[model samples]
Target: MNFSEIKLVVIDIDGTLLDNDRRLHPETMRVIEEVQKQGITVTLASGRTFISTARIARQLKIKAPIIAHGGAYIARVTDDEPLYEAPMDMNEARELVALLEASGYYVKVYIRDELYVQVVTEETLEFCSQHGIYYRVVGSGNLSELDKNPLKIVVIDTPQGINHVYKLLEPWKTKFNICRDTDRGVEIVKRNVNKGTAMEKVCAMLKVEKNQVMAFGNEGNDLDLIKNAGLGVAMGNAYAELKKYAAIVTRSNEDLGVAYVLEKYLLKNLN
Candidate 1:
């Protein structure tokens, strides 16, 4: 495939572009900038909130709108109004929240940009702090009132706890899209709202075809996007299942996986 023919590059943040330290590799950022210089659009799609993803978009100076909350929301970096959103049903979200809390896990709900939590655990606090996400402690507060419409719910716990919750949520999987976004947490979104669907919407807005796009990811939540992209590049650190679905498996994130693929495949002509 001709790299120049690719019009858009959609990247996942956590395990694709960012290393374990949650920071973008300098070489990767440089390659991304180089691609944009060639008139290709580069955007982010993540299981994170728009507010958080937008910050990175701004730092990268990419104009393409970001897909956040695991594709439940898509918005421009400068605006709060979402171009597209699939919020969870309030009643259903409440039921799931109850089940999560009952499982002794801290739950974080996304109502647009704000994150609402009834109680902040060490892991939750660390996550928020590391990502620069502002969270509200709505202790003993009505979740419905705080955010009647939620885009996604993040259940924070140990790996074992998340595994247990995953099993309990298996039945509701038909109703809600549930996947482990990290080793210690699971992200729950409305059914059928995911990276692939969001990528389609983004392509529509850009007048780009699916065959003209490239995507990279490293987790279960990213499976849809990986399968749908014209070129799906999985990181060396990606889950085995995710790797199987990718068109190509690159180096690990810490080894500058994003940059490696860009230079070797997408940016070869430029080099």
Candidate 2:
């Protein structure tokens, strides 16, 4: 494959770009900078909220729009307006949130780039601390009068708990794009929305074709992202299922997986 033809790079955050400890590897950071300097547009495509993704983009000095909310929301790093979006229906979001909360699951709602929760947990605090962001607690635990519609909903629990919820929401499978993005998390977005469709919107805005894009991911939510890219590279730590769609499988995130590929395939071309 002529990787030189790739003009855009979209990377997933959690397990593919961030090491297990949830930190960006120095080599990964350096390689990203180098690739950008080489005139290749590199940006993030993550299941994180716009605010969280923007935080990382700032760290990387990436000015491009980020695909956030697992493809439900997309906006530039510094812009308040969306380049493209598919926010969920407020009625549907509120009902689902109520059910999940009533079931004792830790639920977080994202609306217009901010995180909204009824209560803060050890898990939420630890996650926010690592990402350097805070959550907004709805004063009355009411999302009815929020300023914006929700972009996505997240449920965090034990892996077994996640399965229980998955089965519970099975009837909603046709109503929304529900996914098991992590061992302890289930992500919900509007139907027909996923990272690949979101990337297509980004490509459309940038005038880049699908075959000109390079994407990287390590989970089920990333399946379409990996399949759509001209060069979809899966991390060694990725699930066996995700690896199947990748054009190539790189090292594990802890081993500077992304940088390994960039150094060998893309950066070496600079010579």
- TM match of model 1 to true structure: 0.94
lDDT of 2 by residue, 1-271 (tens): 7888889999999998998888888888999999999999999999987888888999899988899889998899888788888988877777777677668777888876667877777877887777666688874446444656788888888899999999989988787899999888999999899999999999998899999998999998999899888889999999999998888899998898899998888999765
lDDT of 1 by residue, 186-231 (tens): 9999999999999999999999999888899999899999999988
Compared with the true structure, model 2 gives a TM-score of 0.93
Clashes of 1: 0
Cα lDDT, all candidates: 0.87, 0.87
Q: Which candidate leads the pack in TM-score?
A: 1
Clashing pairs in 1: none
Task: Work out the TM-score per prediction.
Answer: 0.94, 0.93
- What alpha-carbon RMSD in Å does predicted model 2 have with respect to the real structure? 1.9
Q: Indicate the worst ten consecutive residues by lDDT in candidate 1.
A: 139-148
- Candidate 2 lDDT for residue 229: 89
Number of colliding residue pairs in model 2: 0
